[model samples]
Target: MRVPMILALVTVLAGCADSHRWSPQQNGSARITTSDRIFITTPADGEYGDNVYSGSGRNTAKIIYNAASAKSHLVRIGGLAENYQDAINQAQGAEQDILIFPTILHWEDRATEWSMISDKVEIKVEVIQVQTGAVISSGIIKGSSGLATLGGDHPQDLLPQPIAEFVSSLF
Candidate 1:
């Protein structure tokens, strides 16, 4: 009876640790002060797999944009760019001081409730100094839903907290 109870407990708790997680919080200096000229670009696209790149750029970009928008009183978001150099040019042409580049590295949408597969998302943020064309600060925020997710939950649901937390670190 005790062995059966232990097995049940283990099964119930399995994969709980796989819930959303991020690493290496925002580092470096040069915070976005209220008076700095800042610009941002939507990432290109996120790769799903098997030569199928999901056009989740704008959607993912907005997730981060809205999360960081608590400081939106002084920000300008540019349209999607082809690559890093193009984004830099856009920022410089606009005469901006800083450029925020958000690239979606990986995105996987899985049905966790029935399939037990967790959805995944990885975003990389680069804060650039336009004048010098140098990255003043950067961070990568990755998240994944738990293997035991309830129905109707996506990986994106796990983004806001860490995103908001990271944004708050900037100020």
Candidate 2:
């Protein structure tokens, strides 16, 4: 009996330390901020101070966003899914020497002021050169949005919007 009780106590203590088990707190509105890095590597023979090569090295890019259990509805999945997917699709279709991979997702719960009803989320992205594995350009983007059930307006909506803005700005 003593051994069983001790095991139970230890299990409970370990579970409490798990961050994923914690729920997101509400302050006022939910917000998500995302950042991405875009890099374009020069061709290998382009002249690395000593050598001259043909073609480009390997153009690469990546995008990382804060990780969290987000409700599909809150992200405008049903309503604005087309728009969101279209943007990424177009980027993939663009003419570039490198290949494009799906955006990697990362999320974590954020603490908010009790008086406020909103929470914060963050997203980031990275682009890398395939051949040389070098990062040419990188950037960070962030947005804040509303909480669950109440998904009408969210500050994080700016996340995707900035993606387009940033990509264009890169050129």
Candidate 3:
């Protein structure tokens, strides 16, 4: 009887684990998306003289996602925009390079289990070089379909993929 009770407890715990998800470590080509011809900027590349908005003088980049897609997208963007700005501010102070204002939209891909498909307008971003007048970088943030199980419908952590990839590209 004790053995049966322990097995039942283990099963219950496993089920609970399935319901509460965690951010997955980025790995595999299918999970991570990268951009070519675009580069990440550093804080040393751009900076302002005590101006809160004054970022590195290099250039500026902005990200925009469709508001109509998922109800969660707005919340995701709000969180990511803050992170992006903070990254820009840090990059400016460190490298003095600023991404140009008015970003670019590469493409948006939706999350799916069997195959990765473009739907739901899940992720989109834009990047530009202000001085040079060039579209420096752009891409869609994406996550694995496996994330759909827990808090599925949409996973908030997947929102950071673009920022992470963009930073990686800069290096």
Q: What is the C-alpha RMSD of each candidate to the true structure, in Å?
A: 3.0, 18.8, 15.5
Q: Tens digit of lDDT per residue, candidate 3, span 1-171?
A: 999999988875653321221222232232112222222332221112342223211212222122212212211121112345654553344332224222212222234433433222123343433233344445544433332233333333333344444444433
TM-scores for all candidates: the values are 0.80, 0.31, 0.30
Instruction: Show model 3 residue runs off by greater than 4 Å.
Output: 1-97, 100-121
lDDT of 2 at 93: 42
Residues 1-171, candidate 2, lDDT per residue (tens digit)? 999999988865653321111121211221222222221222111132343322211111211111111211111111111232343343334432221222212222223222234433233333333334344334444444323313333223334445454433323
- Model 1, 1-171: lDDT tens digits are 999999988977785545554575446666767677768788877777664455577776677678656776667778898888999999998998878888877778887888887888888888888898766778788888777776676556767787777767666
Between prediction 2 and prediction 3, the one with superior lDDT is 3
Error of 1 at 64 (Å): 2.0
